[model samples]
Every structure is written in structure tokens, then in C-alpha cells.
Target: MNIIDNFDTLHRAATRKAMQRLIPLMCAIYFMSFLDRTNVALAKAQLAIDVGISAAAYGLGSGIFFIGYALLEVPSNLAAHRIGPRRWIARIAVTWGILSTAMMLVQGEWSFYVLRVLLGIAEAGLFPALMYMVTLWFAPNDKPVVVGWIYIAPALALMLGSPLGGALMQMNGLGGLHGWQWMFMIEGIPSVLVGILLFFKMPERPRDARWLSAEEAQALESRAAADAQGHPELTSSDWMAALKRPTTVLMGLIYFLNQVAFVGLYFFAPSMIQQMHVKSPLLVGVLAASVGLGFLLGVLILPRIHRRYGNDCAFLGMLTVGLIAGACAFIATSSPAARMVLLAVTAFFAGGVLPSYWAIAMKRLHGIQAAAGLAFINTIGLIGGFVGPYLFGLAETVTGRSDSGFYIILVASLLGLLLVPLFAKAIRRETEASSPLGNGSAAGMQS
Candidate 1:
């Protein structure tokens, strides 16, 4: 039978079984990562003075996490690949858990900075490693949805964290630990427990996956092989080669710009809500959760939009509109309700880019190269992630206006609109050159 016919025979349960096992762990880890990172922001509204740090100094400490994360991303991902993902991921989990517990010792800015850096180092490889695992297990057609599903954890984290994190911190009476300390302790422990559970569950690859019957494995593999046009295996040297590609570099730059906007918005969303004179932490969390809900809806809708309009148009179209909406939201600070609506719209549009971009990355990379390529892309992107929060904090410090720095984000988002068209043309040219008709006439397409 041909590939499509073979795929038609797949036991849906077998295909879904891995996902059922995988999605929870993926969500838990990413949720914990975001919770750990952003919990500081929520805590800051009340805890900064109690913790003996100025607001500006806390911002500096927060920004320090991404710096360590940015520096370690490539090497950590490489290590995850070399030492094997199962053990490596478990190690990252356990180490970060301890770091989370260590947050209880944050008596001042110095200790917070140290623990943030440790958290960064622990989380450095996680997303890229997950992306690499996706390439091994899911077929291309199924991949986008799965990626979107896994990537939704960030959104879910925001949704859950907005209210839940506040409540956890509000539980300061237990043994006299502060809310901030509880935030770390409670969120951090789950990762270690999940890590231990994961060892018994996660398979290295579909071929080795014991959960699937022989027929189920063959069915999944056949679809993947057909979609991927034969699997490309990668050695250590291949990882190096993938990173050297011009397209990879360009994608990295795009990812960098994207994260600047993403991380900045997330790190400050609760604070922004607070600045609008919403004094209740619970209320601020609720508004933030609204944005997360919008994000969740967008991910569900984006794939269908891409199928109809093609990737470039969909990306550019949404981002262009999102930038305008976000700018207007920031500028029109007169009405808090209006600002919240616009922010929700911006979050919705911004969330779509992730899964589509990951799919694009996977399309261009295969095998072990996917891990390193994603790591390199993220490493460059994380420089922006590092810079984003600091930029906002610095601008706020200098101007005494939080809204002023959003202009910079608006400009960055518009520039990202331009990059999408360039990416589209590059993708099309890549397709044509690799086709039988074009030959060496399009030699520049050789990535």
C-alpha cells in the first residue's frame, strides 16, 4: 500500500496514546517554567519592600534570569542531545526544582539574582529539546497541531497563574513563609515529581516506542516517512552544519524580535493592570487570564487560516494588525477597559506565530539538526528575551512612565511584519530551486 493508504489503517488510539502521555508532561514543565519566571512579577507588587529590594532592583534581578538562559541555551541543548533527552530532561527538572526551593532564601537582590540565574540555566534546553522530540515522533501533517498544543502551555500558564499564583502567594500563613517563597516551592515540586513519572512513560522515538503495537508503529512511521520525504539522520557534525545555514540565521533574528515583544508583554502584564489603578492582585490576575484565553482561541484558529492563506500572508497579516492594536492600546491609557480589550487582541495575534513558526522550522530541519537548529534560533532569540524586560524597566525608570517603552515594542512588531515577506520569498525560492525544473539557476537557495 502507498503511504496514504497505510496511514488510513492507523489505530487512532495508538497515535493518540503517546500524545495523551506526552501532552501533560509537556504542559506541566512549560507551565512550571512560566510560573517560576513570572511568579516574581506577581510577588513584586507586594513583596519587593518586604524582601528588601527596590522595584528597579527587582527588575534587574528578573532580567538576569534570561541572561543566564541565553548564555546556556546552545550548550545545554547540545548536552541534551549528547547525553540523551530522557536523563537530560529529568536532570534539568530536578535541578530547577532545587533552584525553585532555593528562592525561599532570597533575603535581598543578590540572592534573588543567584536563584534566577540558576533557574535560567535549568530551563535553557527545555523548549528546543521538546521541539527535537516532536520531530522524532509526530508526522508533518500532525506536527503543527501537536506543536500548537504543546506550545499552548505558555498561554495556559498565564491563565492558571493569573489567579492561582496569587492565591498561592496569599497563603503566607503556613509556617510564616512569604507568598513569593510559596510561589516557588509549590510550583517547583511538581516538575520533579513529573520528571520521575516521565521516565516510566516517554519513549525515545516512535520506532522504539513500546506503547505502540508493531502495526501501529509501521503506520505512524509510514506517514512520517512520506511526509518527510525519507528521514534524514544527523550526526554531531550535522548539528554544526545546520546552525551555519543562512536561513537558520535569518529565522534566529526573527525569533529574537518576536520574543522581545512576547516576554516583555508577559513580564509586565500584571504590573500594567496594577498601574491602571486596579489595586487587587486577584483582579489583575483575572485580566491577565483573559489575555491567555484569547491566546488559546487564536491557536485553535490559526492552523485553518494558514491552510487557506499560506504561512507568510497569515503571519504578516496578523502581526501587522496586532502591532497597530497593541500601540493603540498603550497610547489610549485613558480607558482601562478599552486597553484590556486591545491587549487581548494583541495577545491573540501574537500567540498564532509560535506554532506556525515551529512548523516552519521543522520543515527546514530534520533529525538531530532540529534540536541544535532550534537551540541556536532560541539562543539568539533569548538575547531579546533578556533585553525585553530590562528595556521596559529602564524606560520606566528614566521616563517615570511605563507606557513610553511600549512604543519601542510597537516599532519592533512592525519591523517583524517586514521580515515575514522576506521569509516567504525565501521559502518559495527554496521550494522552486529544490524542484526538478529549476536546477542550478537558483543556486543561492542551497542552505
Candidate 2:
């Protein structure tokens, strides 16, 4: 075969082998993680009756997790960097699983809020640490798709989790537990089991991947080495130096905007659907889960769009889709079935933003520096998660309309759309600097 054909073959073989070993388990873990977090949305009605959680209190309890998540995020990621994924990931999953199960015992607002916070603290590092871990296992160009594959977790969580939570709620009074109680109790078990598996089976790096053949392992290592040479700043082991980079701060802000737009819609989805005259919790959960359909399309479509349009154009497309769709969803009347479809379209773009931006950022960041940078971004960005749900809830409370929150989501999406160009420019400059043709160094770029 010619060189181009030969390279394609090798790339395909390596990707297939590595992903076989990685995606299923990673997706499963992420699935469990997202499921535990978002199931609260599904359990909202039942929990309201059981614990007397008002809309405001429920919003607080849901949003408070991110407060703890944001606070501990950097520390947890750094610890993961220091301690390795096997131990740290296992600890995180198990602890969060325990806390999630304990959510069954919540008697009032304070208990609910406290458990949510503890759950956040427990789950803080999983996203960024996993992002860093992807750097170890995949090439820079491959990270986005890898990250996209893992995002199926959220899609699956919403799709399966909503209905599952609803079904579990139907089990109220079985074994002397409310259905909401049963929902938390049963769903939390898989995480604990997944944590045990991670301890035994998780590989810290490609070098530790026993599943790969020797040739595959060497190819992975060489790809990483080449990436290290291309972006020396990213290869730095100093977490502090990574923190000092202005790109880190910029990416954090970008992540924050994306989270604000997306999580606002996500956390409030079931209620949003319910307001459309869907009374069955099970049916509302199912329709709410349709956001997963949008999410699935986003993840699958982004890589192809990026390859064709380049990062800047691709980001614009993603955000523009969000802007238009979110605006339409905002103006949509509650009774139309079309409202749900528009909301899904909004979700499509909102869901794509994380993988889209992370992919852009990962092209510049790698190694432990990638971990720390991702942590910094995710830490600050998660504050948006807290803000999105809480503020969305507050808006709904004040307006006495569940649909009023769509305007908040639309505003957040608009801000992200306007500012993403700046983010894209920063990335462009960095990519150009990192290019062989350009005078490449991030020295002056530091704020």
C-alpha cells in the first residue's frame, strides 16, 4: 500500500483496539455518574411530596452539588494526577455512590442539600481526570472523538435514567421505601460496583494497558511523545505552571458559559416537559429523555463538522445552532408538541459545546498539564452548573411558570455564542503559535 493508505490502516487498527478497551467501560462509568446526578430531575415530583421540597428548595438541593464540586475540583484532580486513576477514580465513584444511596434518607431541605453537596465533593474529579486520562491513551486528534464517546454516558443516563427513575417511583411503599427513595437506592448500586471494577481493571496509562499488543502499545507511546514535543507547555508536570497559563483561564471561562447554557436546560428538563400537559411522570421522563436524541446527534456529528469546517467555523456552527434553537424554544408555547422538538434542537447544540470546546483545548493541552488545565476550567465552569439550575429555579419561582426558565437558558446560550469567538481566536493564536510555520510560544499570551 502507498503511505497514505498504510497510515489510514494503522490509524484505524489502533483506534479500534484502544477504543474497544476504553469506550465501553469509560462510557459505563460516565453513564453511572451522570445517571446519579440527573435522576434527581426525574424524581422531582415524588421527592416534592415525600420531603416537602418546594421548587426553590429542590433547585437548591440540585444546584448545591456543584458548589461542592467546584470547591474540591482542583484538589481532586491534582490528587488524581498524583495518586493515579485506579485508586482515585475508585474512591470517587464509591464515595459518591454511597452518598447517592444515602439520599434515600433525606427528610427535609437541609438533609437533601447536605447530601447533594457531599455527592458533589465525592464526584468532583471524574470529568477532568478522565479527560487527562484520555490524553494518556489517545492522540491529540483522537481526544475529541474519545471524549465524545464517553459523552454517550450522559445521553444514556438521560434516556434510560429518566424512565428508570419514573418506574422506580412507581414502587413506592414497596419494602417500606418511597419510590423516590427506591430510585436513589437502586441506581446508586451500579456505581459502587463500577468503582470496585475500576480498582481492579483501570489502567493508569497506555504503558499499563495489558489489553494492548506490544505494537499497539508502542504506537500509543510514540503518539504521546510526538504530542509532548509539539506542545512542550502542555507536557509540563508543574500544575502551577499550567495554572499560570492564560489559555487555562480563558478555557475555564468558555467552559463556564457552556455549562451555564446547557445545565440550565438539563436540570430542568423533566419539569419543562411536564408543563406541556404531560401528567404521567413516566411519560414526562420519556419525553425529557428525548434530549438524549439531540445529544447523540451532537456527539456523532461534531467530529465530521470540525474536519470539514475547521475549529472556528465548527464552533460557530455549534453555538449558532444553540442560539437559534434556544431562542425558538424560549418563544415556543407550552402546549405545542413542537416545543419539545425545539427544546431538543436546543439540547443538540448545548450538548455539543463541551466536546467541541474540550476538543479544541485538548489540541493545545496534554499530560498532567492537561489534567490541571481541565480541572481549572471545569472547576470554574461547574460554578455555572450551580448558577444555571439555581437561577433557572429562582426565575421559575418568581414567574410562576416552569417555562419561564427557557428564557434564562436562551440568555446563557447567547452569551456563550458571543464569547465563543474570542475563545476560538485564542485557540487559533495558540494553534498558529504551536504550528511549525509560526513563531510558537505562549509566553506573551499569559495574563
Scored by TM-score, the top model is 2
Per-residue error (Å), model 1, residue 371: 1.3
Q: How far is candidate 2 from the true structure (C-alpha RMSD, Å)?
A: 3.2
Give TM-scores for every candidate, taking all chains together and pairing residue i with residue i: 0.91, 0.92
Candidate 2 lDDT, 1-447, residue by residue in tens: 897677566656876788887788788788899999988898777778877898888888888899999998888888987889768888989999999999899999999999999999999999888887777777766777888888878987877888888888788899898888998999998899998897888788776787776666767766754453364434444767767766677777767866776787788888888777789877887788778777877777865565445444345545666555765655765546777777777777778656766766666566677778788888889998988888878988898777777777777767766665566556557656656778644432321
The global C-alpha lDDT for each of the candidates, from Candidate 1 onward, is 0.72, 0.77
Q: Give a tens-digit lDDT track for model 1, residues 195-218.
A: 776666676667677778888876
Instruction: lDDT for model 2, please.
Output: 0.77
Model 1: clashing residue pairs?
Answer: none
Clashes of 1: 0
Best of the candidates, lDDT: 2
